[model samples]
Target: MSAATAAAPRPAPASGRQARRGGHPLAGTYPLLRFALRRDRVRLPVWIGALTLTTVGTLSSFTTQYPDAADRRAAAGTMDSPAGLAMTGPGHYLDDYGHGAMMGHQMLGFVLVMVGLMSVLTVTRHTRTEEETGRAELVRAAAVGRHAQLTAALCAAALANAALGLLLAVGLGASGAEGVTWGGSLLYGAAHTAVGLVFAAVAGITAQVSQFSRGASGMALAAIGAAYALRAAGDVGNATLSWLSPIGWAQRTYVYVDDRWWPLLPALALAAAATAAAYRLSTGRDVGAGLRATRPGRPAASRALTQPLGFAVRLHRGTATGFGAGLLLLGVMYGSILGDAAEMVEDIPELRDALREIGGASVTESFASTVMIVLAVVAAVYVVMAALRPQSEETSGRAEPLLATGLSRTRWAGTHLAVAMAGGTALLALSGLGFGAAGAAATGDGGLFLDLLLAPLAYAPALWVTVGVTAVLFGWLPRATAAAWALPVYAFVVGYLGTVLGFPDWTGDLSPFGYVPRLPAEEMRWTPVVALTALAAALVAFGLAGFRRRDLDTK
Candidate 1:
């Protein structure tokens, strides 16, 4: 054919092994698994490394802090207190305080959380998210069977979790703690891996039930959170609650203590049942649809959507309510726990000394200061998410519709930014109020509420700086919004982990949170607050100017 004539006929979509009929539709599973593995290599390794490092770092820190029997006994005594036990699982492992037992008891719950998160994200991304975005459609058009996708995703998560577990085992063994046998380390690692597998199966089932990726992921996360809470309550107050949570099962295995190997089998059995149910559900549901159909919304917008700001308010109302409620609850819980710290100190004199050393003032002030720091960190996260709204709307194509209605770009973007800034401030205030109220109720002291309520405000300037950074990124480096989010992640690493791990002063100083004066512990310095506020304002202005000049990304 002539060149022009040849161009008239479109080429067929490319095809390979997927075009073939096979004994098992999953014959091409290895290739798909390989592709997914390559895609996730960098991100997956970072998560795994970060989690393993958390475990190893805790082990190293504990070794230095409690090198001998007397130190272990003191640490165990402090942990045995109800307040500490409530916060950090049961104290059975702490009861026999060898280095291995001490480290395992203190850090296993944290490790399980990390493993569960990794598994959920991995499974959801590959299964529900892919189907939502229509990638699975293209794959399914091939010789791929329904179960093939789920199988591949499960295999990937299993392999990744298995590798992480092995790495953790090696890292623990290399730490050179006495009584830390290879078998014990492997069992500990397997427990975490099993937890991950169970969650992966849960995510798989959730993906089949929920109509959207967000709903699926949310369901999975809710399950994880509930499991943790149940386990925490049970471990702290009653054994009955522990039986209800998978996390409790893993922790109660008591690595380096009794070293019972039977608990892992339940996790494995749960994973198997969950996986089979997910597969059955997958086969029953149509591609690109869910087991639970989406409910219809009203045909028109609500009366509340009349103005730009009102619309912004409506858009953010759900998140604002959820975040506000969660922060309030957290604050109250922290506040209520504060009263018991003094009693705990009375029981463990070394703990009192430790608190005094780490926290500059009295026990009450020290406990309040620690709680405030945690609240600040969490509040900063809310600020970052709020500030990223403009970027998300623009990239997701929602901003184009608003701009097409003759709204000025600056005004449109500014509306969202305004909500973020104001909403963040309100959230911090609410958090403080919540904690303060809870503290006061618990102790019948009105002054405690005032102190807790004021603490979050002290950290507001630093929180605003993070929001400003996100705004600047949205305006100037729209393509790199992920980098903007990374800024807070880096700050968290330095401010929280750096302090706990004894990182150098300069490293901690790099974080804005580190710069914010610790309130209630030390005298509040106005100088840093003012400087941070000015810096935040300048960043917002710079970002807005850049945003005004840049062309809208209509695509």
Candidate 2:
């Protein structure tokens, strides 16, 4: 052959077995992608709808809060400050009643975080999780290529993210906010889409490295959290550091104001590189194993390992530690910012008024109370994640073998419930302690520490209600266990935006968090706390009873 002909790309000759094995490396991806989409139909719509609603609701609030030119100008002055920039972003759209930019600043971090979460969970669930549960083995036993599963997962995530982006852009543009252009709104939506795609790629790689789905999720989520913090730190201090985080890249798009699109290029490149790495990594491992080998455990069981509750603790401890440490850091951040409460309130009259309605004694106390409540919501999320552990265990085929032993189904379920309750309560308490300690150190009011410490306990009952709901779902609606996540999401929406959206009192009353007294700002009420706790306990009992009556394997 001539040199030019030899240099041209050509297919390698196939051996008999190879010829019989399959077609192209990505031959089955489209079908698999469709299957994944089918599986995620309900899940994706809920995420997209919730995100869109949040965006529109935020827009509505901005319009109502700063309805005039003068109000927008004053809001812009405070938002441009280093403290404000750190909390939100550069306030690029703070001018012109910058409802679009203000919405971007207030909602971008939260929206991107949720998008990242959805992407990571979706990718990991289809890839490592399916493989771990032996579902992928059956798929692979068919005419599937090695890379098809991961490719399909990435494709599905991209589609979901795209849908979410479109929803955001269209929804916000129609929200009737003055001065909010469709172009900026599109960029706002595009930013989250890019962020989600980048994290989907991150999940692809982490799924290859992690031996279990939970670990893969943790790695991916940890990356997202780090990216968010890096950008926040960079925005506040060195602008250069923001470039290092994907979230920074999204925020740098400056959705409504500057509307730059260049930042998305790096995110796209990152996704491509990570997806390529995942494919390469997938080749060296067996169908179900990870690129990293599973470490050998102790040959003998410890005393703690002898019981179901202890086993539950061992399996869940890593995730709880991760959540607790993160919340502690969050507490520190909230505490450090309390000193700026007075200025912040003065600069933003809407917040000042909202705090007053919530019974804020002073700016500082109001801010603290808000932080505690927000932190409680965060804590409740952990509770839901923890409470849903049993479903994960059951789906992975690990529960059947354990149930085959002396363990009864109810006892096995109860152990996990106990862990969920204990772990959730402990995490909330630690978050409270961390918040209090940091606040006390800052303000030097020793009593402030004690007061703030007790604040989180009041929210525990509400969180327990969330946990109870998860358990009930896992018990009865095992196949639909994923829907349990919506409970927390709904609660968060109601708790965070109910007041701002002019929701009726009964609507807010639907959330347990709404029932809990806004501690330190409003006096504590025993009736709601006791009532919620009793309901939680009753739910747990009902869930255990349901689990006992059902088959061990819902599948």
Candidate 3:
């Protein structure tokens, strides 16, 4: 035999007994559902707990801040301002002017975003992502039906959202906020869950259409962004635009006010339609193949992949661009509202303290500072994304080929780490610039533009700490890299919720953001910023050293 013919082909595993006798798909739904639940047990609970805590804390804080009808009205008036209306939804729910209603309005969008993010991540990871990685094929060969995997994933996500909704309702009822009816709280929770289900269905469909998990997630997030835009446009201008967005549908529920039950029907119907489409598409595609065909690539590596740094840049550029654009938009919106902050503060005394905490020498400064903090948070998100790239590349086996080249492990890893650290800084600066420009445009003060641009840079050191930790984890505990992403999330909880709820001082201090001096509010305190930067440097060094010695996972 010829040498090429002499090599034996690997045998395919024997297919298990077909469970669906009549060719009816989804025969193994129950078993797949159970399996998915088992897989997501730890993850789902953590998400639910975090979301519940955020909602409950926000409610408690808002209620305490605005205890009386007059205060509620003042708060409502501030929200009805052009800036707040553009950022949050329309002032429809603000009419009642009660603490409960105000808290619900304040928290509804945040909760829905969190739940929807979790839903998309969880569902996509299990369904199309598993198929892309060939995990689903092995399961399918074991008697799992074609639709069983997707069904199981959707079921798991839906169940998680439902459980979270119930928990949120119960937690809110127990929090002792006045006029907080169970029906209102339940409606609020249900609205968020419904949004999550719709996103899960969207993720399912995107998974079928996108060849890669990242692409699937990006597409789903784009859809989410579109929803937010439509909602914002509707809320800022015409009421009809609100009807077009899933977020608007959820908000239209108006929890703690009218508590409309009917809006949920559309969300549920959308989810159902999306799920049905996913199943139908699944039947038409081969296992591990997406509905969208993969385009052919160059036979050889691109010029961009000639070096470790180049490779890292190529891999990370897309993510950086996306984050940068988001930050820029946020900054612009925030800047547009700078002139209105003084007006808002004059109307609402409760906002005075909040504004003071955010950093405003003047009303405009205070508002700019508040917007900067939010911009900082957004930048921090970019840091987390940057830090997570090491883990992602490692897990995806993309790092293996790069490592096999002449590149040292540390050098290769360092390239990505550097991009993350630097990219985060760049994103923060860009956000500040966008914000400053908008503020300057609004107020006709070019000086405000510089101030806004500088605000994010002030928060850079603290943000880098988060990125460093993730790099360290990627180096020393590659298996636990997933846990590294949780650090920033924890920081967010402590920084926002802890401060608002007046939790123990130590709780806020634990966050890197807490340690970082608030810019524009206080003069530069280089000690803490320098300390955080030092910590980040140390983490990077340790991570690189550790990564150099660790075995690369090819699987």
Best by TM-score: 2
Model 1 clashing residue pairs (backbone): 331-435
Quote model 3's TM-score: 0.92
Model 2 / residue 198 / CA error / Å: 0.7
The reply for model 1, stretches above 4 Å from the true place, is 1-32, 313-322, 340-359, 389-396, 438-446, 547-555
- Against the hidden reference, what TM-scores do the models get? 0.86, 0.92, 0.92
Candidate 3 shows a clash count of 2
lDDT string for model 2 (311-405, tens) is 99998898899989988887776766566677656856676777777786787787787777678877777888888888778877788888889
- Angstrom error at residue 156, model 2: 0.6
Candidate 3: tens digits of C-alpha lDDT, residues 1-555: 998879888887544544344244677789888888887777888899988877787777777777778777776787886678778766877888676677656677756777888999888889877876777888888655678788888989999999998998898878778778888878877887899999999999998888788788888888887888788888888889989889989888877888899999999999999989988777777887778889887799878787777878887888888888888988888888777777666755566766666564687886665556677777777777777777777776777876787778778778887888888899988998888888899888877667677877978887778877888788788767667656667766666555456567677576788787666666778898899999989888988888877787777
lDDT of 1 by residue, 193-239 (tens): 99999999999999999867667877887788788888878877888
Between prediction 2 and prediction 3, which has the larger TM-score? Answer: 2
Whole-model lDDT values for every prediction? 0.77, 0.82, 0.79
Winner by TM-score between candidate 3 and candidate 1: 3
Off by over 4 Å in 2: 1-21, 80-82, 91-97, 347-349, 441-446
Question: Which portions of model 3 miss their true places by more than 4 Å?
Answer: 1-24, 298-302, 347-351, 357-360
Score candidate 2 by lDDT: 0.82
> By TM-score, highest first, what's the ranking?
2, 3, 1
